[model samples]
Target: MKKRGWLYFLIFAFILGYTYTALVYNGIWFKFTDGLKTIHFLLYFVWFFVAFFLSLTLHELGHFFAFLFQGIKLRALYITVFVFHKTNKGWRFTIKPKLWVLLGGLVVPDLGEIKSDEDLEKVHKKFANSLVVAPIVTCVFLFIVILTFILSLIYSRSDNWIGFISIFTIYTILLSSLYIYSFTLSNPMFYGDFVAYKKMKEDPVFQLAQISQYTMFSLEDSDETNTYLWEKTRDTLKTIPLKNSIFHIMLLTNYLDGIIRSDQEIDLQIDKKIQHLSISHYMRNEQGLMLAYDLCYYHYKQKNVAKAYQLFDEIQRRVSKKLDPKLTTYYKKKSMHIMHIEYQDEFLEQIDNYYVGNSWIFESLMDPYETLKEYHEKLPFIEYSLPVKFEEETWCFQKSMLYHTKR
Candidate 1:
């Protein structure tokens, strides 16, 4: 569409980079992560999410401009950017003139238009244009805004108006530019919007999908469960897409199948692509969807006791309230169920005690398959802990977590 392959290039590069590094590190998770001095790199990972949010804001702002250009109205423009903190209840990034803070992943882009299905059809096409052009324009404008603001600050005038204006413009542009850069990588994961542009123009199924993609809580209508786009409804533009249109649900379903069913034959690129994609609000929710279940299951199967416990805690907050009913039963009724860390901690404590006393525990933990198998054999089989040793320090993790295994 935009020949904007460069925008996504970095996503691919990072995916390959992260996957390679993870494989190398998996071979030596304890050694690499716990190595001499990686404070800088680890910090970079944490801060990288900030850049991600900024890019998202810029992308959506582009959509806002696109809608305006086509004479469609915007009811709301939510910029879901937030700094990571334990207690903040509002938008994390704020304008000095009027700032706001939020917990992570709260920036929701909501666009509203006139009350007519016909209007929605017209606006839908405009949205496709905005999806492609707006982000590009937003990036160019932001870069200039940030650059001008940088130059503006050099020539300070006590004419308070000049200084204030310069600072205001600088913050907005800098924030936006940082965001645009994040999306403007060489290998993008969410090239579907670009793909959708060509495909949706002809396929009304894709066009109707745009609506359902964002609105998941509500149904298509009171009568039909798997409803396609409803023609008579006044606010039909915002109607939720079918389950088939739910990107996160589909991708996650596939990912879970990979680790649970032991489909190692499936390439990591196919499984983890969701993490790299930069796209619609619906898709972002799919990011990191399979972290907990995969790791816990794998470690238990391998009989590693310690690593599984920590992984459970790390990913517990993302607990899904619902799942495919069969999977819910399969995961829950499994021989080694560590789904609820809170319920099984006392038992895991006893297992941790056994490892601490056993010096050859290192050798025991090294046997990944044996590690999982033994843990599964244990009563009430909790998350098997794999206490990995790197030099002097001891770190715990599960076998299924998948890191680079360096020789």
Candidate 2:
């Protein structure tokens, strides 16, 4: 009932719907006459799942053994995550172990039918002591694989049983080791970002839980990445943020990342982050900075010298004393350097036009002349947005002309 991360709850709900739809479409359930066929598919699915899950079992076992040696109490072991999103099942766990040696469930089998959040809390509390055994198990497997590979080479000359075992174990051990690493590796996007698991791993508090959590509490661990479409959107947002939020805020690292990058990379990452602006209002500054720049450039590129200069001036005024004061100066000089040639008097006058009001964009677009106005219009997370949005909207004269003509 706690209201924390209601967004995550929504996401979980959406995933639930998506998963059910996929299963139904794929004949996971059945009418009475088709029930036998359904059972056959279910059985094979269960068998393969059981075999794969056994690997996670061993992973958790490694952690549980470490806990036992360290004299920690084990409350329960179960495959915790069930019917999550698109997947029929997932893993979570409950264990009472010491503080520093957490990560136990990662080496043992996960739980089944997690009874309550209380079960999770009990496990969460024990994280500090659990042993993160996945890495240990993985490294051992790696060493075994390497040893087998070397031995295989050595015994390839002899045709002995040891050589055969070494070759066979190489493949098994390599796959196991890869699975273990996938669980604990630090990825930089989505759930893989520095925020959740990686942050937990870095922090002593949650790092302790990595063991038990990975074994039964987490499933489908991959190095999360920005798909091309998402990355493109994020890059667009990085260059411009005032217009809209395109993605869920929770999944917006790539967009934010693009904003923080340079002009060279900005064009690439904006489209992704645009999808997720609603994630946080506090992030307005991060998102807005790039948008401010993009707006200025948009106007600049479109030959809308008036609008362009207005946007530029807005950026100049909002420049933080903590930031590079020289940045505003640099861009100003660059502006004069580029525009001074064509629209000599017009561009020069617009450069100094510090009319601090909402009408900056309107005046820029409509060519309205105004005296110094009051300053009640500084929107948070940005110095100006109307200027940028106006500029982006008007950047393509061809598009503008076509639309206006069609009108």
Candidate 3:
């Protein structure tokens, strides 16, 4: 239904765009032969794309500078299809990107730690700067584009000016439409900068969640770091009412707590809470898989093979149906291997084949699993450590940013 809506929207958009062009350039239509010749059209195309991308870059940089203005150091910036991400090794540039990122570029601020109200407020102020500044920048650019279009109209006396006027008109209209749509539209799952800013101002839970999510993403992979996060999150959860919004964060906290503390009763409590939360909340594909993998491990550790298999069945029903078969099978096998126990070497080989350079998942799931310690010993010790690809890295960043606080 969502896809159908977007398809209908695109069809409507195309028709509307054609109608607008026909109306605006009625006078210039006769000059098409002189104005829209191959060379001229290519030049116009190049110029439009360059200006469009430049505007997008400036808008994202507005967010970047705003965060920096609040003294928040940034870790990553995504503009269009390009990504500038930082890791332990250093900052690296990546080409492949994520969807919806092109609508408004993303900046990942390094939110050091969320230890106090002061810390939370500090992050809030920094994010608020970006939300406020980026839209302002966008509007400013839109105004400039409109002004240029108006100027082209004012001087459209020559056949040479025909293409310029028409193209600028298209750019102006397209930019305006996108600006309005992005700023105003709201949904249960997604909202834009303007609405987000309003929520930041009006809702404290939304505000705290925004801050906590980034703070979680900024964590280094270490027992001490995980332990600290578990304690702090445990404290934060005590203060706020438990809700579906913070379930993923709680799931992560519980997973880390189980590893660090190894208390069976607490682990069982965490597993039950996770199962309850999974049933209550809607988890999208990759996000659902993250939770499923954790729960699968918990069930297996509890020596409940039936429960582990049941979890996989539920995954197939609710989440894995939407996922790539390879990805689904990979995670399924990784989780089920705990019970099968005989195909340890085959599983290790598969891990070597697919899990290389995916340090976050490895450290979070496999390395910490006590059942896998023997397999780890058998395998040649190679660092399963490298920064994740652009999509997964952005997922971690956005997942934490969007879902890390109690409502």
Candidate 4:
């Protein structure tokens, strides 16, 4: 574990230990043995949870409103697994629950459409405000709680003292948690509000990395964008530290730009470089997924059928268990059949369905789907053996190194 992770763990463990000692050793558990006592305990327990979720919701809304005020378009807002995103069709709701998301909620802004350094900087400032706003809201809530506690002490009647005390005690705990949350999430490991704010303010490399990723996802891979994006990404790559996880993204974008521009001198070993980074300890799951998506295509284009199928199978296994596989996984069986002409019709049909079905999602897949169509139109006759279906004994072991290696 990272040092920050250990500190967080110890903090939590200490809180739990102290709570346990209070309940069991200090006679608090015995005091709650009767019916009224049990009901009082239950009331406080329920109130604690209710207050906790309510505060979290307000914190995220602070980001949502901040984006609105900053004139930054909202991509999606997430509260645990549930997501609400803007689409051409309309706003839509979907569940995208993951282990990490269960801890907090956040709003995702539409920064994908950046076209130049000016656009990037404008979005960066707006995005920084969104991050800062959430923590400010949390602090405000803590301040309100402290004020309420002080007011209760001064104004409450003797008969109402117990009720005021109970409420204050719960709020006090929530306020303490909010403080801890602000401090803990500020660690870069969480990539939470403070970390994002710090990175945006202090690191030019991080700023350029953000643009590089958004450009790859949003920009059309035509002559207009290829040259400009390639130059920017190359400059970013030159300066980014090797240990940064986004260094892989810069490399991938550079490689993609080269392909789009038809650069004959482009390094053919780009996939190998990405594969090396995908196995690193710092690689994130989403990054691994993006790398796997590209690697499958690269290996297939290279006539390395076995490796392509292996990559595709891993993606398939991950997506199969998802509640909404279409939104999460790009390549279905039909999409995978694009390489072979036999399933060309099915592939085209599936692509149409995917576009129509996912029109409400935040990110657009039009460019990628069009690219697939173009490939289908011009793929020449080439003899190649069919790939075997991949089978791995352990799901954990078979997971992308990016997923398994994150600290």
lDDT of each model, Cα atoms only?
A: 0.42, 0.40, 0.59, 0.57
lDDT of 3 by residue, 136-228 (tens): 887787777777655654556665566665565567568656865787767654668888888877776666546555654463634554445
lDDT of 3 at 145: 71
- Clash count, candidate 1: 50
Using lDDT as the measure, which candidate wins? Answer: 3
lDDT string, candidate 4, 231-341, tens digits = 565555555433435545545545553553344233434434445543333223444444455556555556676776676666666543423454343344443555452
lDDT of 2 at 269: 46
Better model by TM-score: candidate 1 vs candidate 4: 4
Off by over 4 Å in 1: 1-77, 81-123, 133-137, 143-178, 184-208, 215-226, 230-407
Report the lDDT of model 1 for residue 61. 64
User: Comparing 1 and 2 by lDDT, which wins?
Assistant: 1
**Stretches of model 4 off by over 4 angstroms after superposition:** 1-39, 81-83, 89-101, 158-165, 168-172, 175-179, 182-189, 209-231, 238-247, 250-286, 289-407
Evaluated at residue 321, the lDDT of candidate 2 is 51
Top model number, TM-score: 3
> TM-score order of candidates, best first?
3, 4, 1, 2
> Please, what is the TM-score per model?
0.31, 0.26, 0.62, 0.56
Rank all candidate structures by their lDDT, best first, as comma-separated numbers.
3, 4, 1, 2
Runs in model 3 lying further than 4 Å from the true structure = 1-39, 86-104, 155-166, 186-189, 201-229, 236-284, 299-320, 338-343, 351-407
lDDT of 1 by residue, 22-118 (tens): 7476543233223223334454444455455555566666666676677654433445422221112332333221123322122122333324457
